[model samples]
Each structure stands twice: as C-alpha cells, then as structure tokens.
Target: MFETELTRTLNIRHPIFQAPMAGGPTTPDLVAAVSNAGGIGNLGAGYLTPEQLRGAIQKIRELTDQPFGVNLFVPEQPEVSEQTEEAVAQMTEYLNKYRDKLGIVQNPSIKKFSESFEEQVQVLLEEKIPVFSFTFGIPSLDVIHAMQQQGTVVIGTATTVEEANHLEAAGVNAIVAQGCEAGGHRGTFLKSVSESLIGTMALVPQIVDHVSVPVIASGGIMDGRGLVASLALGAAAVQMGTAFLACPESGAHETYKQKILASNEDSTEITLAYSGKAARGIRTAFMNDMQQYPGEIPAYPIQNALTRDIRQAAAKANDSQYMSLWAGQGVRLANDQSAAAIVKQTIDQAYTLVQNRFR
Candidate 1:
C-alpha cells in the first residue's frame, strides 16, 4: 500500500477521499460505503440545517466507525442592489412556465439566507467528528483554533495558491487545492473567480511546493491515471467529486445521473445562471436563456433561493433542460459502478500505477 502522512493521519487504508458534493449528490450511504472501502468519505452539509446535519452525521456513524469528514459552506453575504432585483425579475416568464408544471399558483419569494456555521461547528465539536472541511472560503482563526482544540482535523478548500497560503496561515490541518476544473462552486478567496482559474495540473504542484501543510489535490481527477499524476505532483492525497456522481448510491437525481454518463468532456459549462454564483455543469436551455438576460440576477443565496421551486419541479419531471447538472470537465471519464466498487478499483489501480512508475 502507498503510505503517506495523510493516510496515516486519517487512519485510512488509501490516500483517496470522496469529495463532499453538496446539493443532493452526497448521501450518507455513499459516504459510509467509501469509508467502509478504506478511504475517507465526506458529507456535504452546506444546505442542511443544524438538526439535519446532526441527523446525517448520526446516520453515517451508524453505518461505519471509520473516520470521515463533513464539509460546510462558509457564508458570504453579498449585497443586493436594485439592478440585481431587476435582473432576477427578467426570468419571471421563464419561471412561470414551471409553476404550471409543478402545480403552483403563487410565485415563490426569496427565502432568507443563513449559514449555521457557528452552530454546526458546535455540533461537530460535540460529536467530535474526525475531520471538518470548509469550501467557498476559510473560517476565522478563532473558529479554526476552536475546532482544533476539540481535535477536529480542519481542512480548507482553495482554488488558487493565494487561497492555499491563506488557509495555511489560518492553521488548517491540510489544504484541498481545488482547481478550476473542479465541479460545483469555485472556492476562490483572494481574487475574482475569473482571475483565479488555474487547472489541476498547474495548481497542484505549485500549492504543494508553497504550502507547509499536506496538499489534497482536487479537480478533474477521475481515475487511476489521475491519482498517480496527483501523487507525482507531491499531493498527499486526492479528492474526487464528479468521479463518484455516477455511483449507484449517490443522491443525484435520475436525470442528473443519466446526463452525467451521457456527457462528453465539452458538455459542461461554468455558468452563474442557476445559483447566482459560478459553478460548472452541463449546458441546458435554462442556462442559455439566462445568458440572454444576465445582469439582473441577484447574488448567491438570493438567486439560489429564487429558483428553488423551478429546480425541484424540473428534477421531478426528469427534465435536464432546467436542472443544475453540476459536473467537472472530466465528465466523460466517469464510470457507472457502486461506491464500494469505485473506491476499491481506484485504490487498487492507483497503487499499481504508482508501483509501475517506481519499477
């Protein structure tokens, strides 16, 4: 077996982690399966309430006593101007069509935005979970210290070298070097998302050279080749999101799963139309329509809340045209398999590739 500080620290048989994919793709069963397969699994608790997060943690614990991680979305409060509201209003006609399909008479208003980070941290401390990961931004030093005091291994996600340095300075136990090719929301901290677009191959080695802590490479890593390349670049481990989306135990909707398997490398696009923040996903008609009326959309949670109902309806109808099919540029590399099978295959193959290189 390949040995590293990350593997020893996390007490895992392999240096692989199932990326915590938020917005329904990550399920407790999937997490447990990966953990049971001797890799670290993660729960994406970005959208869950404190109670819900606790419940999911309980379920994961019930399934396995192995070490796993929980990921949280660091809150960013973006100011909404009149122009943003007008931008969102432009989608009125498009959203109305979904109202009829979903049997809704009243237009849904924006729900209040809140991140239960403080409360959720308390839950983690109380539960004494092994690892706590954060995305979108890093938490304050005090918060990190608090979690560290409770023996939680803190990990921060970064889309750039500057963000990785910031995370190291803030005392993160390790850094997840999230590249531009990663799926879901970009976790840029220092610069605008546009300026921070570095691909995995270019970003991983640089962060590994610069950061003091262990670097966990994340992005378009899909198979054994990707894993071997990451290790060669000095990564202590690799975290994969899109690679696991096609797993049978994933919580992704049927339409989302089908679309993932059918997608080519060029099928995904980085668009803010769905959540008012940049995320990579398969191109859809709703995305195209939103582009025609771009400037009016509200920021993040507001825009995210505004379109919740339409997205729900679209999922129920198995309509890919309107759903947020988040994926990485390596969508074409995904395989349809059970989570346990995928984990075992990746670990075994990666080990073989690493051995061949040394020989």
Candidate 2:
C-alpha cells in the first residue's frame, strides 16, 4: 500500500528499485524477479553491446510482464591531451607487473573500449522498455526527448546537488542521488570524484530540494531502516545495489559473495585504481598496491578494459585479492535470499516500522 511519486510515475506497486550492478552481477533473472515482485528491477547494460543489450531486454520480457528498467553508461570520452602518452605508458608499466605475476605471456591490448551508446539508446527505443536509466553523465536533451517520445521513463544518476540540477534540467523523469557511499562508479561529471563526496544524509535532501523531479536516494542504503530514513529525507524510492549482491539470483561469483558477508562498515573504500573513476568496493591487496599509481591511470572504459584479464584470472583462481569486489558501506547487512524474498521483506519491514512510529 506504500505509494510515492516513483511508484506512481513508473506504475509499479512499491517504491524500491534494484540498482543496476554492471560487470557480471546483474542477471536477467534478478531484474525480472524484482519487477515481478512489484518493485522495478534494472538491468545493468553499461558493459553490454547493443546486440547483447537487446537480447537481455527480450529475455526480461520473457521472464516478466511487469515494469522493469535498462541502464546504459552516458559515454564520456576522456580528454587525451599532452599527458595522454605518458599516462598510457605509466598505466601499461603498472599492468605489466600483474601480467608477469599471473604468468601471462601475451597481454591483449584493449581493442574496443566501450559499446556504442547511441546504438544502445536506439535499442532501448526500439524495445519500448518501460523505464531507462543512465549514469556517469546526463544524456543530451535530444536523446532524452526521443526516448520520452517513445514512452520511456528516463532516470539519471547524480552524485552532488549540482549534478542533480543538471539532470533535472536535462529532463530526466527522475534523478538518482548517488551518495558518496554508493558502490560502483560515482556518477559525477560536474566535479572531480574527490570533491563530489557527499553522504546520503547530506546529499538526498539537497538534491530533493534542488530538483523538481522525483529523487531516488542511492548508496549505503540497506534494509528497512535505510528505506524509511531515505523517505524521511524526501526520497521517493531507494535504489539498492549491495543489498541485492548476496541474493541467490545475483550473478556475483561465490568468492565475491563471501566477501560481502564478511565485510564490516569500514571494510569498503573509494578508489580510482580499478576503473580510473571513484567507486566504492571492499579493499583488496590489488587496490592497496595500485593506490600509488592512481594519477597515471586512464579514465573509465579504457582502465576498465585494461584490467579485465587480471580480474578474470583472479576470479578463476579464487583469489579475492586481485578481484574487484564492488560493494557499498553496508555489506555486512547483506543476507542470502532470493531477489523476490528481499523485496518482499524490505516492503513488509519498512511499512510495519513506519506505521509503528508515525501512524
């Protein structure tokens, strides 16, 4: 019975969204389950090709007739200026050490940095998906309008109040206020990642006040307490990534799941070592060692592509040290449950707690 602008706008039953987790964690089953459970499940399409993204959407449709979302990365091509060659050289030298350690003779250069964002958007429009979301930066007004004309509800991620303002002006149907504690890449383009650090408590209300669109609070939110707290701060819904990482439907490796259950509040840290963008994850030996070479690193798709082999090698060997264990600050609160079960539990617990306290 809990309804908010998010639910009303998206035509979903509850004000919960399974925040899209890119790389390997977000599966069609997980997305479908969330939508089927009355909350919106968003498939992370940032790392997928246009063909792959289309197939995934088709699979989601096969699995659920309910509302769901598909997310894409707003392409931000790094400015390769005078420091470009030096930075690439430094990054290569740094990766060479890992290549030697992992006993790989041939290190494949990053061929295709990222899938085409424009083509991806076209696929979303062709599919007529119920909702669409983008992170990293806001898409242009033309792109947003095209999708909207096709009846797509657009959502954009923002890390600071200024970014929220940009998204609002860009005409996103809603804004995801991604606090500093959020896992994955921080969606901040207006400022450097270091300067955009704002906690959920501070960021949400400011964004809620900054924009007229419905604000979905994200980052460090887990369970019913976080849900109720976000609503109190004027959020229409909560987008949780880490809370769903432990669910049975998640595609996260067994080792990654273990780390989530073992982590505490301070176990995670924000660093640019992984993808050359600030993202929160459980600190690993690799992250610790790469801390020194951060400035030399290239941005986004390039850095992400460069680290793919080593991460896969670590995963195959079950070496948690070298794997990118992306998570939020509330990892310890995670539990082993189905995605549907988690959604139902959060709805029941939050509604009961709110009624007990305010009604």
TM-score of each: 0.95, 0.96
Candidate 1 residue spans exceeding 4 A from truth = 78-94, 97-103
Per-residue lDDT of model 2, residues 228-303, tens digit only: 9999999999999999998888999999999998999899998877777778999999999997775667887778
Clashes of each: 2, 0
Q: lDDT of all the models against the reference? A: 0.87, 0.89
What tens digits encode model 1's per-residue C-alpha lDDT throughout 50-83? 8988999999999999999999988885545676
Model 1 worst lDDT run, 10 consecutive residues: 105-114
Runs in model 2 lying further than 4 Å from the true structure: 79-83
TM-score of candidate 2 versus the correct structure, residues matched by position: 0.96
Q: Residue 319 lDDT in model 2?
A: 88
Top candidate, metric lDDT: 2
